[model samples]
Target chain A: MMTNPGNKVTQGQFSFLPDLTDEQISAQIKYALKNHWAVSVEYTDDPHPRNTYWEMYGNPMFDLKDPAGILLEVNNCRNALPNMYVRVTAFDSTKGWEAPRMSFIVNRPPNEPGFRLLRQERDGRSQGYSIVPYATDRPEGERS
Target chain B: MLDAIAKGTAAPDESVDLQAEFEASNIDEVMDKLDRELVGLKPIKTRIREIAALLLVDRLRRKFGLTSGAPTLHMNFTGNPGTGKTTVALRMAEILHRLGYVREGHMVAVTRDDLVGQYVGHTAPKTREVIKRAMGGVLFIDEAYYLYKPENERDYGQESIEILLQCMENNRDDLVVILAGYKNKMDRFFDSNPGMRSRIAHHLDFPDYGVSELKSIAEIMLGEQNYRLSEAAAKALEEYLPIRMRLPHFSNARSVRNGLDRARLRQANRLFASRNRVLTKTDLITIEESDIRGSRVFAEGKLEGEPETKAR
Candidate 1:
């Protein structure tokens, strides 16, 4: 055992996307990452009303692919929620690193918490809890 | 001597050359012409003049500054339906153009359906198209509340709103945007968007017309159509109108116009059966008491013939 307090597990500052170059999108992703928040992004090309959330990793880098199977690289890490699918198209990477290409699509589900919380609260209320006397006589802790 | 000279000249075609005189004037001409067509909107007229003056001043200011652009006057008109909001908006476009704020006095009225697109990517271009159409003149958005609905997370309405905010900011020097709807709903809409509330600086409220005003409006309409209401018939209409107008569904000016149209149809039917091809001066087309008393031509289950209830 070390003499110093060395076995501590420290939570790192959550960075959602640290590599995005576009300032607005980068800031938005940063905000989401900092707050453990989610964002709705149009992630598909079929023109469906679909959005997804991505779990933010160490540094957000997107592996983008186009309909033509061309890979584009996005290296800017910014804030993004887990499991969010962002609609993106592949583009050539500026870093010359064979990065996958993806274009910033319009954000959907503009408000993150509006519907989810309401649904959760409604479900909680519908599955109401029962109140019971917890070992009413608990035997006084078995008479100590 | 001058009185005799004026009177003896074949009564000087005493018809007064109303059209020629009315045409000679500018603002007053439009107002007078509209007065013959539209009735009993005294408050609206006053507000219209206020807006016209503002437009005139804005134009003068632009000229003084030697600017080639016009100033946009953002207004919010709140009232119930059929209170002549759209009519006033159309007239306002003409007045503003006459006052030299816009090159063309066209008014493009739109609903949410016109601006908001179904998909995410399509909304910006769609809204831009609407703004382009309304560039030179007034763009009137009716029932603006739908544009700020809280539901629909994938709301194309927000995209439209964002685009509209940008358009209003960018073209503040040229376009005039008027948002009109029920007062409470419009208040909610403004409350929803800070940008909208801040940009729309003028608010005009259109109050519902009373029975007397409605009657006057109806008489004006008849006068314009070359018909007159007999004294007893006018009185009966006044009394009958107050009662019918007190109903919740009854709309000002519009309701009165509808009632007059029904009465005219009834009179026409009666005249057709009486073998009268042309109406003589003495036998003028007049709205009669029986017309207001209700006839088979009037819709059934209506407030007609019912005990008159006072509007709250």
Candidate 2:
């Protein structure tokens, strides 16, 4: 139903809703811990949907029984890059469960300047569309 | 429209008439046009029909409250150039549209240059832009193997390939990507990139047109331009087709079309040289044997490539 050709980096679950509260985040971390899944936190200034390699907040808390440890790491990453996007991921090490099982963004910039859609008319009745994040218009690192 | 197909639930005893749904979709007209437009691709045609039938049946099943995962329509069109790959992709897009698989069936054709960028940060935006334009319908990527480059140390093509594979998997429901290129190169590409190979559902190999099919295609091309090849000219072309095929860069039907275009040019020049003579419409329209014979092809054997469009 979204008509704009622009792309928004809406990765992971519950992305369309508001940022999860600490209580909600704790509930999700607890659920992941219950399944014996390894919980990891990652943060990135370049949160492009295809930019899957986010900076890990230390090693994944493997074999950790407590959800409070992950919550601490998530907040730590958020404190370091308060204006950038941060996410918490759950991974299972069992055979055939190779990729991350679930992940969600828990931090976002206040303004969330979105992206600008660029269109160019090409030869032979062709058109090209691409998007640039609003923050990228400014210099690197200064982007919110 | 999608909701209409998704929401309807038939009673347990109700019958689903496939013929009625097929007629209502009006995809038969598109198939007929494909048959008329292309010279010969029997296997490809049958594959298209099979896919259409599959989609139609899938729609019918959905109507009966049957739950089946959406079928992956991403395809690989492997063949030589001028083998009607592009033409078939356009028709496939129409079929997808009529079947309600994609909203707008218009195809966006691109090659590696259109996607892979020269710089580190450039490839993502460029590839994403192309995907955005190609979101609703078909994205026909010709020479798709070029998106991956193991030889080039700092090439940004790998980045583009990663993004494309990601998009192809994540956006399967709305977008259909048809990767086309030389068959062997595509195989090698898949050999390196297993992710892409796994995602592709249909592999449509477009066989090269035979000499006879080339001749008929010439007639159709000439007819479209209101020009008819005289009997001798047709024979001249029959000779030309094989020679062209042997020479480097003989791109099947495209080469035939180009050869006819040259013949028409020569015919006009011959008519122009006989100045001060009133010419009949027949003379103007007819491509005489002499017109085609004048080509360097006759002076020299067709063993050599055309000097004008030589292979790189």
Candidate 3:
């Protein structure tokens, strides 16, 4: 999938960069493997800032040794969900906090619609602002 | 285009990233909440700050590549009933979560009955299920000493303890087990289950509130509910707390809360009886001298239904 650079949602580590090269992605995957981190691919049609949990493509690749194998899985996810967002996450278990230490966007749709900021005035001079994804607000079939 | 993009068009290290929006807020807010919510347990408060600070320092060190180890986050809270042990434990969970030590940062409080099943072959599944539910948060076992019943041969508490010990060691990265109970019973619990003691990283002792502290706690409680105590009412509480503290089944803060509840009931009845008169807002909010029916006052012969208004 391809995306307009300006409309691409900025998320994950290194999201400000253009889509990563295979070599660079492989390097990070290798690093995760070296640290015994379980690598997993997650995809989501929504990339809202507050959306923390993404739909995991499958179970974590815990026993994977070669980065190419994970790369294939990532590519397959990108192919199947061409219009959705895909990311590779590495979960490090050595630390007592079982959380994803590294996650980076690997794929995006061809036409990435950005987000909108909504503000509401509260009691007196107070106000609250919420960031809502324009893509998510659109009907599923019309999301592109 | 895909082939060209995959070849070498982008560099991994050459990029800016969005500033993560979900970075946890300052741990000071959690400490401030503890201070605002909890009344008086200076020792417990100090211990919590010390532990939070140490964990923060350790995290900073690891970030700077100075040192790295899996620091145990589990704790042991030993205290009397209603001494704010559960309150402190909940606050500590929030602090740990805010500091990035715990993922979910919530607590799942349970007792012996929640963990150990009544019959054989059921304890493991039950314990594991509870542990699984508490995977991303703190699992607080209140009155943890009750878990073990060495006197009762059929008690499955030890089996549950064994399963918990395994999970405590294996799933430590995701789970925190806090065993809390009375001081002496907890000591004996640790002595009996030696594995549990070694796994606990922090130990906090919640001392019973002094008379003055209990008075302040009651005052704070009343203040929150928009009820003010008169001077005589305050004096009554000061005298009543120490007496209650010496008695059996006398919970520290809980007793004060109960005393306040009784006073509120008396105030309501007093106001209801005077409902015929033109009453100001002040009349409804103040706890009068006559309304300070502490157990001491009830024990002694006191005339009730007296029409006296002495507002301080």
Candidate 1 lDDT score relative to the true structure = 0.59
Candidates ranked by DockQ = 2, 3, 1
User: TM-score of model 2 relative to the true fold?
Assistant: 0.67
What TM-score would candidate 1 get against the native?
Answer: 0.56
TM-score of each candidate structure, all chains considered together: 0.56, 0.67, 0.61
Which candidate number maximizes lDDT?
2
For model 1, the interface Cα RMSD in angstroms equals 18.8
Residue-by-residue lDDT tens digits, candidate 1, A1-144? 433243211111221323234445544443433333222233311112222333232222222111110111122121242222233332234556444333344222222221111122355466433332222223433411
| lDDT for each residue of candidate 2 in A1-58, tens digit (9 for 90 to 100) | 5653243458899876767899899889878877888888888777656678888876
Query: Which model is ahead, 1 or 2, in terms of TM-score?
Result: 2
Per-residue error for B302 in candidate 1, Å, reads: 11
| Candidate 2 local Cα displacement, residue B104, angstroms | 0.6
What are the lDDT scores of the predictions, listed in order? 0.59, 0.82, 0.78
DockQ of each: 0.01, 0.02, 0.02
Instruction: After superposing candidate 2 on the true structure, give the runs of residues whose Cα lies further than 4 Å from its correct spot.
Output: A1-144, B1-6, B302-312
True lDDT of residue A33, candidate 2 = 73
Write candidate 3's Cα lDDT for B93-186 as tens digits.
Answer: 7887877777667788999988999788888767766775576578899999999987986889999999889988877777788889999999
Off by over 4 Å in 1: A1-144, B1-25, B31-43, B55-72, B275-284, B295-312
